[model samples]
Target: MLIRINQDAHPIAPSEITPESLYRGRRNFIRAAGLGAAALAVSPAFAAAKLGAIQKSPLSSTEAPTALKSVISYNNFYEFGTGKEDPARNAGRFKTRPWTVRVDGLCAKPRTFAIDDLLKLAPLEERIYRMRCVEGWSMVIPWNGFPLASLLKQVEPLGSAKFVEFVTAADRATMPGLALPVLDWPYTEGLRIDEAMHPLTILALGLYGEELLAQNGAPLRLVVPWKYGFKGAKSLVSIRLTDKQPATAWNIAAPNEYGFYSNVNPEVDHPRWSQASERRIGEFTKRKTLPFNGYADHVARLYAGMDLRKFY
Candidate 1:
């Protein structure tokens, strides 16, 4: 049975969706796991039952929810593997349970919260958000979790804290992708203090009414709807509040290509590709990309007076 939740905040035009990308993206993983199409629709019923139990923020989208299969299989977690399908096949080796997030740096009280404790830190709500990739592809996803601010507030940041750095869990023994010199190991990402505390930014725990898959950044991950997908670091282990603008994995690797802010801007296209348009997963045709991934009215104020093209 399919479950539908009431979302009354974000309005978007009805969009065409397909389960093909989700399935096709993970075809190799499915074949290796001895699973077939039947497994694509699987999600824990308990997770569905837990939905809306927490205080919800009336955040919703009119666009239909992408198929759960596509949402899970079509991923860009380089930790598991670089390919879209790599995580599904190799991420199973990642151990997510007994995870702990170390909150340190310019904070009043440095503390570590276990995965279980972190879930209890705030009310978990389901947010339907539009995710646009830097590669010019996009997907509308329903992410389940609380805002990043919820966790940040618990640790109590000092006044000097300027940037929040997120460090992903990197274990060479389990992560095969680390062998390749893709970006620096133990991927790092950062957000301005205000952006980290933004209402739209969340630390997602699950999606489509189930726990996160290792390939999809199980245990914990950031969700910055207004920025490119890479800005949302996956499988995070450390969240350090600092005074300086922390260098991100992508930005450090390719300063010219990936910027620290990485906000979704059409005017400033990627060096190699056009950012004016994006291909929605499952669709053959491309659609005009929106500034700040269509959250401009709400989030544009965050960058008032500053030049996005320069930071981007």
Candidate 2:
């Protein structure tokens, strides 16, 4: 089934349908009540199989997408649990509604935007991106959202802004895993000012042509295609622009394992495992990893002259 919203209201469309073995080859996740008014505003089959104004980005991968089940059921959202399947099982009860994101720190205008208001800030686009996890696994996902820079521009960052920090929520009532001291509470991630403002960086609001499921960081999340998957913090509650580099969850927990840059480099091996190759989610055999997760051409210049090994 296809879903759509009114373009005048800024619709978030899905990518073109691929082989059933590729993307959107799973159960429909969005219900009538999930989108509420947005779903009601347009025809039932609005923008069938099209991503509306959200165009297919050139940087997206052409490879077949990982199964939706694998994408949702297997993840590293510690807010739900440490196990791979923990998020899918435990995140169902997590409350994503009534969500808001506070944009503050070194910016000319700092304000809190409710999810609905945020959606109206700019038109949503569909971007298919490759997500490589620090655990050496990977997947290609189609995300629905707008460029994060657009939102940042609205607030107008000051000259002092050098870094962008993303902080997640830690409510035990919604997120049971918060009870555990795993990786510290309120997960955080960061990006350099230039990196954060890059067109490749986006705020993901949905996937597979539907509203995002809680297990997948519903409401709002970050998607930095060139960086490791963990670098994109889920369930984002706040965005802070600061003059100094901000602390990230993994970097704080185990500086030796994860780094501030966390760029996808085959040459830099994880302390416990090799990052030279990774297993595609649905495939058995592993594939050679690429520099900057195969986005080196578009992003390599950003890190030119810097020792990636030392910085990462």
Candidate 3:
């Protein structure tokens, strides 16, 4: 069932959107710095390159998007580093091109798709989604990509495929944080077959109308806005359809703290933080955290008859 949320009731005006020229100008300034990847990684002036034609999606949220600077600079890509700003400061040399995603396991048409081929597979759309972190912070980001279902359908899962596992790229050379004994290397995430095929779940390629920066999971990433940001695995390398629930990075690292289904539930607080309210990025005040990050009406049915507190 395709469920459309009401968040898009107030569509953003064209004038409110950031201009592409501004991003190009920022890229030019970074080029002039001549500091190469190091400069690009640390400089707040660095911006993503422009993408080809894109179509606006009706699934977008009406909330004002967080500034591009904050969206790129303040990140949680632990493959680069643990600090919130570490991704932006350390992912300067990370490579994303020539990337390919392998889709296999319990599927009839298992095949590896190059990043270029994936881009051409479907028409890209802009989806402004509300991202909620387990740390109690949030951001409304304009993500550019196509529905994950669009790609999953191409492989055609078998009846035995009950879950989907996502494996991220873990390059020791480019990702320095791999040296540290953090959660685990090659971050992994998963979703039930129904959730995987949800219309709102997208495979993001870029943000703010530009190709994604290395710090932002360039080339490809999963974006499930209803769940905590950690559920959106970055720099994905493989997608496997499995009969058993695959172990995820966080859930494996701390099962008590991070559940397999990390849906946004205001009633269920994080072990270290409260999930009832959240501080939106760039805002001084906190707002009530909506169930499923304000997508309850569209996604609540997926969890019907299940105890969120227990399953969460």
Best by TM-score: 3
lDDT of each: 0.84, 0.84, 0.90
In the predicted model 3, the residue pairs found to clash are none
lDDT of 2 by residue, 162-269 (tens): 999999988888687888987867899999999999999999887776666777787789999899999989989999999899999999999999999999999999
Per-model TM-score versus the true fold: 0.83, 0.84, 0.87
Question: What lDDT score is found at residue 144 in candidate 2?
Answer: 83
For model 2, the run of ten residues with the poorest summed lDDT = 40-49
Candidate 1 lowest-lDDT run of ten: 40-49
At residue 276, candidate 1 shows an lDDT of: 99
Residue-by-residue lDDT tens digits, candidate 1, 1-312: 334555655455456454687768776786554455323323221112233354445665668777777877788988777898777777655677679999999998899999888877888888889999999999988888999999988889999999999999999987889999898988999999999999999999887756677766877899999999999999999999999999899999999999999999999999998999998886768999999999998799999999888999
Q: Highest lDDT: give the candidate number.
A: 3
lDDT of 3 by residue, 132-166 (tens): 99999999999999999999999999999999999
CA lDDT, candidate 1, residue 52:
39
TM-score of 2: 0.84
lDDT of 3 at 209: 84
